[model samples]
Target: MAKPGSSGDEQLPSNEERGCEGIRSRLPLTTLELFFVSVIFGMFSITLLCIYITMPSVDQKFLKIPRTVEELRTLTEYVSKYTDSYKPQVLAGFCVTYIFMQTFMIPGTIVMSLLAGSLFGIAEGAALVIFTATAGASSCYFLSKLIGRPLAMWLWPDKLRFFTREVAKRRDYLFNYMLFLRVTPTLPNTFINVCSPIVGVPYLTFLVATMLGLLPATFVTVRAGVALNTLRSFNELYDVKTVGALFVIGFVSIMPAIMSKFQSQDSDRSHSS
Candidate 1:
C-alpha cells in the first residue's frame, strides 16, 4: 500500500542520517573561511619574518626537513656553531614552524621539538616546546570552533564520540580528564585540538589542561633531543620505560576524577537507601 515513489525507509531522515549529511555538507571550507585562514597564516608568517630580520642572524636557510640522524646531526652542528649569532632567528623559526603545523594539523612537529633540544639544550628546549605546543593548540581550537568543525568531525568520528562522552561525564573534573588524555597519548593532540571545539570543551579549560598535560611528554621528547646523536629511529624515542612513565603520570592526573566517581556512587547509594 506504499506510494510508488516512496519506501518505508524514505519517510524522513533519521538523526544519524541527518548527522551524516551535516558532516558531508560541512567538510568543505567556505570562501570566507578560506580567506580568513589564509589571512591569519599570512600575518603570522609575516610577524615571524619581522622578528627574524630584526635579530642579528642574517641567515634564514636554517629551516629544512631532516629525515635521518646524519642530516639532523649536521644541522645541529651548524646551528650550534653559530648559536651566539643565530639564536634569535632559530627560536623565531622554530616557533613559526610549530604554530603553523599545529594550526594546519600537519605532522612532523616531533622533528622540530627534537631540533629544539639539539640546538637549545634541555630547559630552553622544553620551554620552547611547551609554549609553542600550547599556543598552536589554542590556535587550532579557535579555528576548528569557527570554520573547521566539519573536517574535524569527519576525520575523527569515533574519537569524537569518546571525547564528547568523556567531556560530558567529567563536567566537574574535566581538567583532570584532559590531562589524562594528554599524558597517556590515548589520543593524538591534533585530533584533540580539532575535535574539542565541536565536542563542547571550553576554550579556557582546553588551554589550561593542554599547558599542564603536555609537560611530561614535552620534557621526554625535548630531553631526547639532547641525545639526538644516539637515537636510531623516531620509534626509539618512546620506549617502554618512557611510555610507562607517561601512563603513571596520566594515572596520577586522573586520581581526583576516580575519587570523585566513588564519592558520587556513595552518595547515590545513600540516597537510594
Candidate 2:
C-alpha cells in the first residue's frame, strides 16, 4: 500500500533537474581544450610514428647501450667533422640538429656534449651543453603536457613508472630530486625531461631543476673533453669515480635542508620558553 502522495520511489529528479545534474556531473570540456590536447599528443604521435617508420632498427642501431670505447670514438669523430669550424652557420646548424637529436630520442648526446667541449673549450663547452640540454628537455616537457599521460606512458613505459613512483615520494623536495635524477646515472636525463610533465611536475620546477641539475654532468663531460682522445668509451664520460664524486655533491645539495631543520627546531624550543 502506498502512503498518500508517496510514490515510494527514490525521489525522481525532474527532467530539468536531471539535465542540470548531468551538466554538473559530466566533466566540462571545451573545443579549445580538445584542440590543444590533440595538438600536443599529435606532435608526440607524429614524432614516434616518424621514428618507427624510418628507424625501425632504432633500439638496436642507435639506442643500443654503447658499451665499447670505439663506438663512442667513432661517433665523436663523425660529429666533430661538421664542427670543424666555429662559424655562426656551423654553430646554428649544430644547435638545430642537436635539438632534434634530443627531442626525437636520437642517441650520442653525451658525445655531442663532449664535442662541444673539444671545440669550445671547457667553460664554453659546459655552457653550450647545459643550455642545449635544458632547451631540449623543456621541449619534451611541453610535448608531454600536451600529449597528457597516455602517450608519455606509451613512449616511455618502464621509465615513467619508476619516475612517477619516485617523484610522488619526494614531491616536497622536487628540486632536489630533479637534481639527483639529472646528476646521477639512474635515469637518462632526456627521458626524465619528457616524462616529468606526464607525471605533473610544474614548468618552473622542471626549468630550474634542469638548469642546475645538469651542471655536474656537464662539468664532467666538459673536463673529459679536455682530454677527449683519452675517452675511448662513453662510460669514460662518467665512470665510477665521477659517479662517486656526484653522489658526494648530491649529499652536499641536501645540506641546506639539514640546516633549516635545525633552525626550525631551535625556534620551536625558544617559543616554548
Q: Highest TM-score: which candidate?
A: 1
Query: Clash number for model 2?
Result: 2
Best by lDDT: 1
lDDT of prediction 2: 0.65
What is candidate 1's TM-score against the reference?
A: 0.85
- The TM-score values for the models, in the order shown, are 0.85, 0.66
For candidate 2, what is the TM-score?
0.66
**Model 2 ranges off by over 4 Å:** 1-86, 155-159, 258-273
Clash pairs for candidate 1: none
Q: After superposition, how far is residue 223 of candidate 1 from its true place, in Å?
A: 1.2
Candidate models: Cα lDDT each: 0.79, 0.65
lDDT, candidate 2, 51-80, per-residue tens: 445422323354332345566555555545
